[model samples]
Target chain A: MSLVFDMALVAGLIALALHVVVTRDGRGAILAFMAFGLLLGIGWARLASVDVALTEAAIGGGLTGMLLLRAQAHLVRHAAHPAALPTDRRRWLVPALSCGLVTLALAAVVLAFPRPAPSLAHQAVASLEATGLGNPVTAVLLAYRAIDTLLEKIVLILALVGVWSLSRDAAWGGASQLRPAIIPEPLVFLARVMPPFGVLIAVYQVWVGADLPGGTFQAGTILAAMALLVMLAGLRLAPQTQSRALRLMLAGGPALFVLVGFLGVAVAQGFLSYPEAIAKPLIVGIEAALTLSIAGTLALLVAGPPDRAPEP
Target chain B: MSAIALTSASLFGLCGAALVGIGLFCILTHPDLLRRIIGFNILGAGIFLVFGAVARRGAAMGLSGDPVPQAMVITGIVVAFAATALAIALLRRLASLTGSATLEAATPPRSET
Candidate 1:
């Protein structure tokens, strides 16, 4: 029964995916892509990685949908009418063949690979308990090799900053004033039901990660999803100016990381090395800050610059 | 069960690859910039599928599963989203400045588009 269900879901994904690819209207394609993300979230859950499942649902399905819809609204107003894409163009033949060959080669290589075995991931899991987190992934994220995750957060912030700077002088600020978008009644009903429980689930995922498949990333994703739902329903408007609190929240993760790292230097010999005596508290604090920061960064990505709302 | 799981997984993987190929075709053929962006998103989804399959394959081992790749993929997805947003902003700006609805066709000069 489970296998049958999995097959059904995968089939649905492939069908939607094909539909999305074939659609001439970019807006319709974007909506299909969002649906695919939700299918992917389900795919992950069925595969048993609850953390990934949650994150996929939140970020991949939820936040991404919001961003695409917002961008599509602008593009539709500005772009040409939908027409069948030109497929008779012969000049693409060589590049197309080359890309096809490359893709086939990659698929063959993956098919030939042996089953995975224990290594870095296993090692991380083995030593995870020492990190004062219940979830091995969380331990891997914020403790074992937290430096990588820290830099990643910085990357997200930098990307957003780059977007803001590039469009800063342009007519990007009128989306907030665009004609009030209508939210379908069904979606409004669903949004109201999902968020409260989603909040609880997101928090539960964070709190029990010491031995389970949940963590700050998954939790932040859920928070981002809630924000996305609100945005989609027009319950919230993209701010014309970012609030002071939003600014602090945006900088919170990096700031907290630096603050905690320096404190570690004061107490220990190296940066970010929590003293054995207070490791749990330090982990909890850093994780909480990271979660908030991630949530803010994701929300902003979907919201874009409140300053650049394109006039409807 | 494992055999069926592996097969279905392989099938999805193949579908993903096919999607990537079609998306590339769309990118190469479509003159509309927005359609090209859609192509890129399709391409990314294909790559994401490969990563998901890798994670499932890892489950076969009696290990606690590697969080590293999954973490990396999650991080990559977010970063990709941010990059896409930036691209959309730049593309929109480009569209407004030039008043050209078909930047893809104009760029390569008798090339792909």
Candidate 2:
């Protein structure tokens, strides 16, 4: 019975992905892509990775959908006419055959996967207790592979820089107005009411993440979503791109992580190697800073480059 | 692992394979930058799903899946989002400046309408 349900779910995922690819209109494709992300989240849950499922739902489906929709609206005036584009039959043949071959090769590899798959689960679990993290995933992220997490934070910052650099010279150091000019009453009402609860949940997710599936990424995404909602409803505006506080918030997490990592060289085994005595608190400290930075970076990423001149 | 679980993993894996194919086709054939970006995301999702299946197969020591890969997937999702945002921002800027979103080769040097 469970297998049947899983099969159906996989079928639904495939159908949605196909729809996303084949849809004629860009807007339609984006909507389908969002649905595809949600289904992919469910697929992750079925595979028993709840942490990934949360990230998929929040960042993959939710934030990405918003970004794409904003882009769609922006491009509506300049968008190419799909009907006017030439669609020759011969243009499809090579791509279709090559894609088919790639799919078949991948499917073959999947079916032929080793019977006793090699894994790091045992190694991860064995060393997990030393890190004082209940969640093995957390241990792997913050303890075993701290460098990856640190670098990922840098990637977010770089992406934000890339986005801000796109702004015109006059708009530099200005506010990114994410909200539409017109606001509806119900949205304003929800924005005012939802954030308090969202804040609580975001904190809870980060706090429990040391021992559970929740973590900095999921928690930060929730916080970003709440901020976006408030901005969309005109309750607040995105911070100016060049605000010192905003820049500090964006850099604090990674800077702190790197500082602690270098400290490990003198205090522990190597860089990022937390001393056993203070491991838990140290990891938690890093996560706290990371959550704030991630929230700020994500919100600003979606807000795009500043569009308006700074208020004189 | 249970036979049922194995079967489900394989099924999902195949589904991911198909998604990768469709996304690849879309990326190759579509001229519109937005569609290509969407296709790139689909391609990424497919790759993550395949990795998820690998993690599931590695479930042992009383864990549901390999925590390392799961952690990696979470990180991958964030990075992918950042890349998508950058791409879209670049696309928007390109459209604003060039007044065109399609990236087809300008053989005839078509003028912006």
Candidate 3:
């Protein structure tokens, strides 16, 4: 019975994906892509990766859909012509054949996966106690492979910089207008009602993440979404790019992570190696800072490049 | 993993494979930059699903999946979102500057002989 349900889910996922690729209207494609993300989240749950499922739903579906929908709206307003649909018969055949072949090859590999698959689960579980974290995924992220997590944070910051650099000279250091000029009453009502609960859930996710499936990425994204909602409803203004407090919030998590990592060299076995006695507290400290930084950075990224001139 | 679980894993894995193919087709054939960006995201989702399947098959020691890959996927999802935002920002800027939403349409037209 469970297998049947899983099969149906996968079928739905594939159908949505096909629709996303084949849809003529750009807006319809994006809507299908959002649904695809949500169904993909369910697929992750069926695979038993709840942490990934949460990330998929929040960042993958919610935040990314928002960004794409906003971009689509912007493009519609700026471009005189709508995107042209591919109508040439000669263009279709080769791509279809090649893609089908690639799918077949991958499916063959999946069927032939090695038995008694090699894994790091035992090693991760064994050393998980050293980090003093209840969640093995958290231990792996913050302890076993701290450098990747740190670098990923840097990538987020760098992407934000790249986005900001696209702004025109006059708009540098200015605020990006994220909300549409005309706002609907129901959206404003929901935005007003939703954020307090969103904040509570975001904090809860981060706080429980040390022992559960929730973590900085998932929680941070939730916070980012709430901030976006508030901005969209015109409850608060999107920050100017040069705002001192916003810059600090964006850099705080990564700065703290790097500082703690270097401290490990002086106090522990090596860089990012937590001393057994104080490991849990240290990891939690890093997560707390990271959650804030990630929230600020992600919200700003979705807000896009600065558009309004500076208020000086 | 049990037989049922193994079957389910492969089913999702195959779904992922088909998605990658579909996304690649869109990226290669679609003229619009925004559509291509969406295609890139679909390709990414497919890759993550494949990773999830690997994690599932590696489940042992009472864990549902391998923590390492699951952790990696979590990180990958965040990074992918950042990349998508950057791409969309770039596309929006291009549209504003060039007055065209697609590369093919952006070029100057040739005069008939």
Candidate 4:
């Protein structure tokens, strides 16, 4: 029964992906990709990676889809002219054939894998007692692989900078205009009603993440979505790129994270090491700060580079 | 390939391979930068799913998948997203400057105001 469900989910995932690639209408393809992301999330769940499934759904399906859709809307409304695609029959065949070859090669590789696959599961769980994080995945992220997480956070901040720098000189240090020319009634209502619940769910996820499937990425995505909802509905202004507080919020999590890592070198085992006595509290505190910063960064990312010129 | 296996890991592994093919096709052939960005994301998802299948094969210690791979996938998903946002921003800027969304050189240039 479960295999049947997995088969069905994979089938849907493949079909949606095909539709996204082959569709002529740009908007329709994006919508299909969103469905594909959500289905892939379920596929992850079946593999017993619920935390990944949540990230796939929230960031993969929800946030990325919103960003693409917003970009589509912006391009459609402001393009100097409709850019027509060159339809070349010969151009299509090479990519199609090459990609098919790649797929067949990869499929063969997967099928040839040896039985009794090698893994780090035993080591992960065995070392879990000291970190005090019941969730092994969380341990890998915040404990065993702290440097990667810290660097990833820095990468995110840099990406935001790259996007912001794309703005015109006059619009530098300004805010993107996210409000629609006319707001819809339903959007306004949902923006007003949804955030309270979204905040509660995000908080719960961060708190339980040390012991369960939920964690900072999923919670941050949720909070970002709620903040986006309010911004899109014109209920709240998007932050100006020049705002001092906004810059601080964007950098706070990683700053605190680096501070702890250095402190570890002096007081604990080494860089990013936690003293066995207080590892849990230290990691949890890091996650809490990260959650808010991630939320702000993602929300602003989807909001795109600022367009409104700074006040004279 | 020696007679195809029916394990869930193998099955999803095959699914992921096909997705990579489809996404690569889109990226290589699709003219619209935005659509290509979508293609890039689909390709990322495929690669992650393949890794997920590998993690699943390592299930033990009361965990369904290896924590290491799962953590890596989570991180990959977020990084992929940040990269996508950057790509979209660049695409929009290209459209604003060139007044065209595609890179093909044959499209006739427009007169500047």
lDDT per residue, candidate 2, A39-87, as tens digits?
8899899999999999999988899999999998888876544322235
Candidate 1 lDDT, B1-113, residue by residue in tens: 34633654555555566667766766776666666776777677677666666665565336434566666666667767777777776776565566555654444333332
Q: What TM-score would every model get versus the actual structure?
A: 0.83, 0.96, 0.96, 0.96
True contacts kept of 4: 0.73
Off by over 4 Å in 4: A80-87, B1-4, B107-113
Question: Relative to the true structure, how large is the alpha-carbon lDDT of every model?
Answer: 0.68, 0.88, 0.88, 0.89
For model 3, the superposed segments whose C-alpha errors exceed 4 Å read: A82-85, B1-6, B105-113
Interface RMSD, candidates in the order listed? 3.8, 2.8, 3.2, 3.0
- Worst 10-residue lDDT window, candidate 4 chain B: B104-113
Q: How does candidate 1 score on lDDT?
A: 0.68
Rank ordering of all candidates by DockQ, starting from the highest? 2, 3, 4, 1
- Candidate 1 residue runs with Cα over 4 Å from true position: A1-8, A82-84, A89-92, A115-118, A167-198, A228-237, A240-242, A262-269, A308-312, B1-16, B60-64, B105-113
Ten residues in a row with the worst lDDT in model 3 chain A?
A: A79-88
What count of clashes does model 4 give?
0
RMSD in order of candidates: 4.4, 2.5, 2.8, 2.7
Per-prediction DockQ: 0.37, 0.58, 0.57, 0.57
Check candidate 4 and list the clashing pairs.
none
Q: What's the CA error at residue A232 for candidate 4, in Å?
A: 0.9
lDDT of 1 by residue, A83-180 (tens): 45556557567757976886787677557556543236567656655676666566666776777777888888887776666554554443333224
Native contacts recovered by candidate 3, as a share? 0.82
